[model samples]
Each structure stands twice: as C-alpha cells, then as structure tokens.
Target: MTLPVDPDLRPVSVATADGSGAHYWVWGDPAATTTVVAVHGFRGDHHGLLPIVVGLDDARVVTPDLPGFGVSAAFDSGPHDVDAYAAWLTTFCRQLHRTGDRLVVVGHSFGSVIGAAAVAGGLCPDALVLMNPIAAPALAGPRAVLSTIALGYYRAGARLPESLGNALLTNPVIVRALSEVMAHTADPALRSWIHDQHRRYFSSFADRRVVVEAFEASVSHDIGEYAARISVPTLLIAGDRDDIVPVAAVQRLAGELTDSRLLVLADVGHLIHYERAEPAAAAINEFLARRLGGSTSGRP
Candidate 1:
C-alpha cells in the first residue's frame, strides 16, 4: 500500500562503543510519548520498515541501518555475530532513549533475532515486536536445502577477491530469485514492487566481509534461544506460510517467552513487511496500546 504522503523523516547518527557510526531516521513526532526502534532484516536498510512506520502514526519511530548496512559504518573490531550486534543495539538504544519515553523495539527477520538477543542480554525496552522472527535454525527449517546453498554462496563471496565477491553478492539475478522465493503475494504489482525493493536495497551492506559475517550470524542463532531470558511483554507476528521459520516454530517460541502474544497471518510468507504491513502495524498498535497504554492519536 502506498502512503498518501511521505512521512516527515529526520536523519540522526550516533557513535557506537565500537567506533562505528549508527545512522538512523526518525519518523512521527519527536515528543510523542512512545518511541519505537524498528530494525530491518539482513542486507536491508531502514527502507524495509517504512510501511510499518507509516502505519504507526501515534509513536516516534526510529529506523536504523544497522552497523555495516546502508550508510552505517562497519564495527572497528569483532565479528558481526549475534553478541556483537546485541551489544551494538544496546548501546544504540541507550543513546537514543530519553526521560519519560516508553521505548519499544520492533524487528523483522534477522533483526528479530538481534532484538531478542539484545533484550535477553539486558536491553530493556518496555515492549518488543518481532516480525518474521527467526524462531528456528535456518538449517532445520523446511527450506534447509536453500539455506545450505545460501551458506555456500556466502562463503564463496567471502573468499573471492573484493570486486568479484561484491559483484556476486549483489547480483540482481540472485537478489530477485531470493525475493521471488520469499514473497508469497499473488498480486502482480505487489510482487513486482517486492522484487524491485530487494533489488534496490538488498545489497547496501558495507562490504563482502560484513554481509558474509551477518549471514553467518543470521543462520547461527534463533529467537527461541533467547526467549526465556526476555522479561518484557513481546509480540510475535509471523506469516503462516513463511518457509524460513514455520508458524509452528513461532508458536513454540511464544510458549517459551515469559509473556508473549503470537499473531499468524494466513497465506502470507516471510515478506510480511512488504506484503502485509497494514495488518502487522494494526497488531503492533493494538499491542502497544494494551501493554504500554500509549496514545492512539493519528497525530503523526
């Protein structure tokens, strides 16, 4: 769905502990009582979450291009593993949070894993929303064969020379193939837009090393591993048709969390942010209202 008008977005940047700059965009009112930090999936920037941001008119939304993606610089030290990303997220939220603001974390796909890890590691947001969360190992999912092939693809990209590796990783053909596989929508226009979106932003990573390391991190961990440790009320929005993490896995993840609600969308696949943004946002708004008692005004 196209937004009637572009949301007013303000660009902001912060220096992380690792010395890399975390670049982000702020949407909605700055003084809004609720603040949301929306994290995008692997190889994507802030643009992936814009549809949700547009629907969340009552809260201030912060969409960050995680370190090593989009305009953000890569970490000066350490591998781009779950722990490193969790630490970076902790520092990023702490720096952006303010007095009297209710902070909420919204993550999609790989970002959901990062959010869960960060929350389990002591990044305390008032509430958490995970869209298309990685609730099970990619290798164990129904798409295991694809996952294995992707593992090798990333490995080859990492080992190749810089120019060749970048070319292979960012190839339009491969990006479109991945997009077509994940996008379950039947609407031709929407499917085309999804492919275009992937073609546009799926290769914005800092370098081959960062993308490969991030891919390893994405496949290495799942939200279920950290669910029991998370104390905050959480919302899990899953596409029933998701091939990466099945709906059953997400239900199991909800049972593992201390307090969580699961919403499964029918006929939707892993590309909920692209195909089912309106429903996802509606659920998120309802969750925030019920759990955090925030404003529902369409002020933004």
Candidate 2:
C-alpha cells in the first residue's frame, strides 16, 4: 500500500504555545483559499488517509498526525482527551486559516470525537465530516470480552520493565493480530495491505503512557453533548459491519446532531476509508459540494 506523494504535498509543522508541535501533510496549492483539515484516528497517522486524499480534488487538504502518533510530539501537558485535543486543534486551525478563508474539518474514528468537541467549542468550520464515528465502546458479545482482556493485558504490560513492555507491544505476532481485528473486509489484498501497515506503523507507537491514556480517553466521554451543539452541516459515515462502532450507534448520533445525514456502507467496517476509499471519497466530495457548496468534480 505504498502511495505516491503528490508533488505539491509537503510535510508541515504547526507549533503550539506550549513548545510542542503537530505535524501534518499538505496537498494542493499552498495558497488555496479553502482547506480541508483531516484528523486521523487512534493508532493511525496521516498515511491512513492517503486513499481519501487521492479522491479529493479542487481544494487544499491537510492531514495531521494527532498529538501522540506518527511524527508528532506527545501531549506532555493535559490528558489526551477530546477537550485537550480540541483546544490544540483550534490553535492549529488558527495558524493555518487566513481571513475570509473557508474550512471543512474531517475526522475519522476517535478523531471524530475531537472534531465534535472542537466545533462545539466554537472552532467554526464550514462543514464537518465524521467517518466511522464511535459513539461509545462496543460492549456487546465476544468483542466486548476481547476488548476487556486487551485493556487488562495492556495495563499489566505497562507495569513490566520499560523495554519489556515496548517489546511486547511491538511484537510482530501481536501487531498482526491487532491489525486483523480492526478490519472486517473480505478482500484479501486490502486485508494484507492493512495488516502490513498496522504492523509497521500502528504498532510502533512508542509512547506506552500516551497509548494507554488515549485509549482510555477515546471510550470515556460521550460525544452526544457536543453533537447536539454542533451547528455546522455534518456528514456521518458508518459501516454496517463495524463491530466497534455499530451502525445503530451512528444512527443514534445522527438523531442527536442538530443537522446531519448518516450514510451506512453495506459491507464495510471500521476502516471505512481504507476498505472503500473511492466511495468514501466520493461521499465526502458530494457532501462538500451539496452541503458546503464547494466544487463538483474530485481528484483521481
């Protein structure tokens, strides 16, 4: 799953007042008047959104590696929760946005929680797109038990010697298992690519404390409160096969939002963008055009 980097795309860093910075990839003209800011989910980086990026045309896109993942610095100040992330993102957007410029904010998985918080906190993006939004932890059936076991194991692993814990988390077998569990697609090629990506990048998140804290924060708070307050037009994408964030929860979230439309992908799962990038991107493009009044055609 090696993607071609756009010739105009380059790595950029946005420094915070606290001396730490967030790193991201930028695509399209550097001086574009409108920007799409995409945030990756838990255990993901800018690479996770490459397929979606390919489908976007006619606008500048910026994808950031949230605080503790990818090449970005860890959140050394407050808890890695929605509120803290929203605050950081507000600053990051302010740095990128010029007067009279338009913005569309997109978030995947846990990133959606942060996006909702940011909008509720008055970040003021013109449109919001939430892909595979997780309203709460999937605490049903065997998956619930497995999730509990995984958390317990993580807590125990954290207590081991630092080197031992890191080695345990980064083990090839464990990484492969974790990656496979995140997907529901039957496409062998796509599954293989996802496993490889997760083994190489997702499992290599070096900060154990940040990993545990972020995991806890992801399922702790309900985004419904923020959803109710969000005034921006929103497109909510859900995968019917998503075990972690079921379509039922997504429907409930849509009901809670002030203005939104929910799209359920029949055979897709948590990795909506990865499994169905073309359709995902098309859906996003349509949303941007119809809801946000942007361009009609998208990129290849």
Candidate 3:
C-alpha cells in the first residue's frame, strides 16, 4: 500500500477522560490536506488497518479503538449508540491539535453504519468512505433477528433469571460462530490479539443494556436517507465476496448518495483494507486526489 508511509507507527491514548478511554495512532504529516479518521469494524481493534491508513502519504491518519475494544476495553458507559459514538467523535476531533475543519471519516463494516448515523446526526465530516459498509436492510435478516433476541435475553435476564447474559456471552456455539466470522486472518499474533478482544466480552454494565439501546436508536439508521444530508463528497467501496456485508448494500448506497462514487473489486473479502491493502490504498489515494483539491500526479 504505497510503501507504508509510516511503516511502524505507535498507538497513543487520545481521550481526555478516563471514562472516555480511547487509543489512537497518527500517521503521515499532520499538515496534510485533510485528516482521515479510520474506524474499525465489529470486534476489531485500532491497529487493525494501520497499513491502509499509513499508505495515504498525503493525508494524516487517526484511528481509534472504540469502547469495548483495544485500550478502551475498560470503558464502561451508558450505552454504545450512534449518538454516543458521534459525540465521542466530536469530542475527540476537537482535541486533535490544529485539526482545522477538514475531516474524512472512513469506516469499515459496522463502523460504516455507525459513521453514517453519525454523519446523519450532524457529525458531518468532509467526506465519508464506507468500506464493505453494513446498510440497514442488509442487517434486517437473520442477523437482526439474532441481535434482537440477544438484546431481549440480556434485558429479560435482569428480571427473571441471570442466565441470558452469561450464557450467550460464553456460549460455545455462539463463540464458535463469531470465531468463524473472524477467521479471515492467518497471522497468529493478529488472530490471537483479535480473539482476545472478542473473548474479553462480558455482560456490559447491564446485560445487553448498551447494545439494546443502540439497536433501538439505530433502528432507522438508513445511510442513503442520511447520505443526502451529508454535505461532503463520499466514496463507497465494496468487495463482491464480502462475507459479512453484502455488496448489494453498496449498490443501494450508490443509488442513494447524490455526490458519491462506488468501486467494486473481485476476489476480495470483508476486510478489504487488510486483505487487498495495495489496491485499497490506491483507490483511497486516487479518491482524495480527485475530490479533495489535490492533484492526481503520483496517485494511482
């Protein structure tokens, strides 16, 4: 990915409060055209796509591990809804030294939906790059059913029996299924680190309190309807063979956004940035060059 601009960047704490626990990594020169805030997918940590962010030499990179992941694992809060995430983003952005108004949020999978919801609710960054984004309708099938059921179980366990939260979180079958979904990586260290993050899962402050509340708040989170509200350029990238997010969601997004572009690549997986790093980096660089007042001199 463009020779890995900041090849071995280190992670640092970025939150101003203990309750707001967040770890981040900054790549490239800070005085670039714009800063890219890369959000990781579900169960992923901050360093998940370091290579992808570092590849774009002309842009500054800022990545965070949301609560329940990475160094923010100890962050116990009210709920993990889009509003909370969006608020955290706003708070964090204001803290960036001399960041100066230009922002481009690039979210992957679950992060994309959350970012879209954030953008809709006025977290309006300059541009949105959704990679293998999870659209509302695509998550309306078995995934939704399972999510709703989990929330219900988490909620009910508080009143009736204390089985749901513990059982589901530690359930062998469910764990196996989740593990399978994360089986895309072959690196032992990376896989082990991610699996540990997943295994750190326990009952939240309340069973499914945060997730259930987030699910409700995120019910009508349609990125398309909000895409029109986004006052910025946008890009939607999808891998036809993504295991978690369907490519059709990207197609739906393309039809919804007024100033947006779509790029579909074959033989790539859900974690396109991690799997096909070079091409993904090229696409991102090319996009910024064409849309963000930069020249397409050396960009692919």
Candidate 4:
C-alpha cells in the first residue's frame, strides 16, 4: 500500500507551566479513544516521522518539536537533558490531554530516552513504542569513549558565546558530513531528502545551550535502567545496520524490559522511521491493534 502524507497534521500550540509556548502537530481523530504522542529524535522536528504519522488509523498522533528544536522555544526552567524532556512531556501532556487518558507514546532515537524515563517515572502510557532506541550510551567501549568525548566537547562548546559556538558547530562542512552519515538509505530520492533535511533542520539548533544539554543527557543516559521499570506494553524497533545505536544494544534493551519485544529490520539504519516509514508504521499499527483493538486504515 502506498503511504499518504499526513494531511491532517495541523500546527498547534500549548502553554508550558511557565506560560511559554510549545508547538506541536496533530493527526487523526482529535477525540479518538487512544492518543499516540510521537516524539522525534535529536535535532529532528515533527516532519521526521511523517510516514508513521500518516499510517496511524484509529488513534490521535501528536508530533512535537522538543524544546529548542523546530518551532518550539528553548526550555526555560531547566537543562535540556533526559529528565528535563520528561518533565516537559509531563507538562505538555497535562495541558492537552486530561489527567487520565489512553496515551500510547512512540519515541524515536533520543526521544525514546525521554519516553523510557517518563514511563519509568509513572507517566504510564497504555502502550509504548520505541524506534531505534538508545540503550546503554554510557557503557564502556571505544564507541562509548568517543561518545563521551563528543558530549564533553558539546558541553564545553555550549559554554562558549552563542556566536562562537554556532560558528563552530554549524560549519557547512561539518553539517554536510553529519547529514551524510545519516543518509543511509539505498533509495536515491529518500537519501537526497535526508541530506536536505540535515542541511535545513538537523544541523541547526535554536539555542546553543540546548545543544550541549541535549548531548550531555543523551550520552549520559542508560536506557536499561528505565527499561526494566517500564510496566506498560512496549514494542522496540531496531534497524539491523543502525550505526548510532547498535542492534546489539537494542537486543539487550529488549531483555531488560519485562513485557517488551524487539523487531529487527534488515537493510535499514538509524533513520528507520524516516527511511522505512511504511514498515515502521505497519509494525506500530499492528502492535496497536493487538493492544488497543483497531484497524490500521486512517485518513492521512
């Protein structure tokens, strides 16, 4: 089946506790019995998960640009770490959905870190879907050591003046290389779009401070800790060739979550939802059917 672009996606804003605005896009039935909050990964906006959003049928799907990315303003109260995102999510949910609503959270990459933390802290979504989740970023290894160093650099760079930091981090060559690393699909058109998105959005952050805080949170986070505590029905999607979060890490994460199952996709990479949204959405839709009882067909 051919995937449709999420035509129902409409921009909406809600006030944070401190009265600042948080922007998000919503798709599907607004008053649906189930609501799926789709959280994008680091340096990504709502559009990143368009495929998955388009395929959602019987539930409302929300895509928000975590503070300091996309149209949302920088987080005002605290650091842009995992805890901060979780807190922000709690506030965001409270503002939109009632205190007790059937919420199914779908998080990708870094966003999964926030979701896992929220679930552990008792946000208690009916169903939790983690796509390309970050498992044990702090574990010891060459990759871990490199990640630590890179995060350290971001922390220090964030301390620098905004102009200086932007100049350093937003260098054209560096941005291009970063985009190239993520454009791993075999399809030429999708690969080109990925490169374009990296150039336009992923490489740029609204606040340099958010950059440092997000990196510090992402690298320091250990998903296994939160995974073990997640009591909600959970589904994990892992790309076989995922370079950022290795498939092995995802396998271990599945083992940690008591009620979780892992679905590994072949010939795919870190940009699982972006590159293979159909299959990604299909998996999520099917999972939701079993958990929430609904068809996958929807108005996109």
Candidate 5:
C-alpha cells in the first residue's frame, strides 16, 4: 500500500565502515556544495527522512539507515546500546565523508540523540541539528505496560505464515502508543507514511533479539552531559505539541550545547518541517549560510 510521502527522493547505498552493509540516500545538487547527512529515528528508515530532506534546499541531502534499523542489517548483538550505534556511525562517516565536503548532521528524534552521542564521541561535523530530540521521557502509564506485556506475548506466540504476521499487530493500546510516539510529525502525509511504515516494519523486524536490545539501550541512555560539551554550532528544533519528546527536554538539550540556537514551534507538533516546511527550511538555511560561509578548506 502506498502511504503518504514524496516519491521523488531515493537513496544510494554507501559502503559501511564496519562492513555492515549500511545504505543511504543521496539527493545530489551540483549548485549546492554542502552535504547534509540525515540520520533517521529509531526503527525508522530513510523514507521517514523526507520532511528533513525537503526542508533544506541549495544543498546535497543524504539520509542513511543506521545499524539495526531500516536496510542496515543487525549486528551479532544488534545495535543495542547508544554508544555502539554512535561508534558504528563515527566509523561510517570517517570512511564515507569526502575530504572537501562540508558536512552538517541533521537528526530527528532518536536519531538526534544518537547524533549528539556521535558528536561527543568525536564524529566532528561542522554543525549538529536536532529535531524533537528526546531529552527525557514521559512515563508509560498502565496502558503502556499492558501493551508491552501483550507484545511480549504475541512475540512469543506460535509460528505463523510469514505473510500473515499483520494480524499480530492488532492491539489498540499498542496502536495508541505508536500514535503518541509518532505525534512528532504534524503533517498528515508525513504522519500517515510513518504509521504505515510502523505497520510494515514492525511486522518484518530483522532480528528480534537485537531490536529488543537496542530498544532497551535507547530507554536507558541519556546524553545530556555530552550534549553540553558540544563546541560546534548546534540547532535544536522542537514542536510544542510533540508527544514523543517533550519540548522541555528539547530546551534542556539546547542549554547543554554551548553554541546552539533553539526554536519552539508553538501549535506545531513534531513534523514541523513537513507541516511548516518553509520556515523550518529557512531556519536551517540561514544557519548553514552563516556558519559555512568562506570555509577553512579542510575539515570533515
């Protein structure tokens, strides 16, 4: 089924640093010299990166599926921990980033958190842009607990025909949690596409053990301190109505970054780039133009 999303942009596979078979999409534009590498959210593929890809023009766009997500294969233990994900990404960039390419890393939600970790661990991009990044979490209520337990049961159920797995995805509370998690994207097109992907991707998770491990890692990992030490020009964008990551958390992240600017879209939810693409694009464009002007010539 074709859900709502732009069909124009496509990804090009790049060699993985650790020989992990990572794939990324590149929107090439000769007029634009800078290459903005986009990292997607948890359990999210590069398609979910459309809003961000469209948000920036006059620059080449690159969106990649990190390990244990999207087209990237799961490692032996999966990419369970935040540090491991960042380490893998740090290696990916070191191998793929061209010598003369001006680099900017844009990460959304879980991707943003991982991006911050990557920066602190020495990924060394010129700037870091985080959208609706997770600073803290809203506790999962009774319903959340029930849903997790139920998903646990379903995951352990008897084997069925592979094509018939969609039936297992039928818990309302689970659906609601997904709805809440995805509240970050305000655009219907973007939202629907994400929802559709959840239905599809959740059913086809590559390695269950690794995915669960990664999920546990994400829940336990917090990079507020590392975020604070960032010396690069950083931009944090938060949607006031976002349910996944609280605006307060986004603000806290902004406070941590030494050279950072924050934007709070009042009435806008997580997918502000899709719902209010122009202004969002303008914010990023203005920042990039100011920072990337007259380059120092040699930096990753």
Candidate 6:
C-alpha cells in the first residue's frame, strides 16, 4: 500500500462562509496548469485520497478535510446538512481558486453528494470527478438492510451520553469491521494497512453530533439528485464490486448527467482510492486531458 511521495505537499487553512476553519493539503506543483479540489468521504480526512493524489502528479491537487472532520472546525452556524456543506465547498473553491488554472472538483463517497450539490448550486468547475459516488439512495441499494442497520447504530450512538456515544462511534473493533466490509482486496498486507488507516483516522470527527449529522446527510441524499443540474463535463469512476453503490447505480447516474463518462473497474469495491488508485488515476488523467485539453505526461 506504499504510495508515491510528494515533496511539495503543504498544509493550508482558510476561513469559510460559515466561519469554520477549513484545513487542507496542497500537493504537486503549485504552478501546474490544472488544479483539482478533492473532497474526502465521510469520517475520512485528506489522507484517504493521498493515493489518488500520488498518481495525479501532473496536476495540482488540493485535498481538504471537510468541516467537522480532521482538523477543520465545525460550522459556527446552520446544521451540518447537504446545503450547508455545498455552501462551504463553494466558498472554499472561490477562496482557493487561482487565476489561469483549469479548476476541477473531485469527490468520493459522501463527498460526491456534496460536490454534486455544490455544482447544482452553481459552483462551476472545468470538470467534475466522482469516485464511488452514492448514485442511488442507500436505503434502496443492494445493501439496504446494512444501511438500515447502520441507521439504527448511528441513532443509538446519538441518543446515548456524549462520552458513551463517542466511544461507540470510535470503537476500533467496529471501525475494522467496516473497513473489512468495504475493502475487497485479498492481499493481507494491503488489507492490514487499510484497517490500520481506519483505526487511526476514522474517529477524528469533531464530536458525536457532527458524526451523526454528517451520517444523516450522507444517506439522505445521492448524486442523482443533482446530476441533471451539473452542466460541466463529468467523470465517474466506479467499482463493479462496490457494496455501497453498485456499478449499475453509477451507470444510471452517468446516464442522468448531461455530459459524463463512466469507467467501471472490475474486482474493486467501495475503497477504490485505497485498492485501485493507479487505475482510477489513469482514468482521471485521461478524462482531464480530453475535457480540459491538457498533457498527462506522467499519468499511470
């Protein structure tokens, strides 16, 4: 699971419209012609997308830790819902956007929903990339039963005492189990690394309230809700074996988008950023080159 190193990686922080401090990392050459703003999945930080960033060396990639996650402070106003997140993303992109850069927005899992919402709200980027996007309602997906179970789990955690709620939510055993379920890799080394990553960063949320509210937001909405409103060229990289959102769902989502291409990876699951970063990055590079007319010299 070792990834390519980025010597230029640096930390950055910016104040958002909601008065929350948005902490992020900038990777690759700052002078690169293309800039990608990457949003990580629920309960995850920028590290979850570093593998993909490693492969995207030709473009500047900015990975942000969404509000209430990692080092980013929670929103000072409004609930942690889809609309609030979309507004925050819009502000973040505007604040970090550089002149003469081909801006792109990339999101994974829950982040995809937020990205789509922002685009629908008029945050126009050169192109959009959704990795393992929740294309359909989780309650209607193949894993509806599991989603229902998770709903109860989050509800129980939210109803308990603050300390106990955080304890249940951050339990290492549950985190490993979730990681084991999402990760389709058979390599013991990679599986162990994925598990270790979850154990380390999955519980870094600001508090139980944020976790519960974000989970609710993640499951309540899907990318399809805003697919029609997204006018920019879009790229969807989905895993055929993804338990969270199957390839069929992603295909449907692609059909809904006005301008989009779908790339399905076989033998991969929900954790594409971890298990299939190289191939995913290859697809992304090709899509960007075609849509933005840029050179992908080191792609793949």
* Full-model lDDT for every candidate: 0.88, 0.78, 0.64, 0.77, 0.66, 0.88
Model 4 root-mean-square deviation: 3.1
> TM-score of model 4 relative to the true fold?
0.90
What's each prediction's TM-score? 0.95, 0.91, 0.74, 0.90, 0.78, 0.95
lDDT, candidate 2, 240-288, per-residue tens? 9887776777888899888899888888889987898888888888888
Ranking 3 against 4 by lDDT, winner: 4
Residue range 1-300, candidate 5, lDDT tens digits: 232245433445665655576777776464455778788766567776666566575677777777766667766543457888788778877666777777888887777778888999888998888777766632242234543654464444324443433343444456547655645655677567556555554433455555555555555555474775578998888888875566777777777778989988777676564455567667787778778774222223
- Give the candidates in order of lDDT, highest first: 1, 6, 2, 4, 5, 3
Q: How accurate is candidate 4 locally (lDDT)?
A: 0.77
lDDT per residue, candidate 3, 164-261, as tens digits? Answer: 55465446566556665744666777566545444543223233344445445444354665667666788888887775556776787787777888
Q: Write the per-residue lDDT of candidate 6 for residues 7-82, one digit (tens) a residue.
A: 2345665556668988888877777878899999999988899889988857888888899998889998777999
Candidate 6's TM-score reads 0.95
Candidate scoring better on lDDT of 3 and 5 = 5
TM-score of 3: 0.74
Superior by TM-score: candidate 1 or candidate 4: 1
| Runs of candidate 6 exceeding 4 Å displacement | 4-10, 296-300
Candidate 1 stretches with Cα past 4 Å from truth are 3-10, 14-17, 294-300
How do the residues 1-300 of candidate 4 rate in per-residue lDDT, one tens digit apiece? 133454234566555643446778777777676778889888777777777888777777778878888778887667788887887787776566644457888999888999999889878777899998988665354377667766766766677787887776667787778777765777888887777767777754677777777877777786786876898889999999887778888898888888887899888888888787888888888897877655532223
Model 2 RMSD to the real structure? 2.9
Question: Residue 115's C-alpha lDDT in candidate 1?
Answer: 96
Tell me the TM-score of model 2. Answer: 0.91
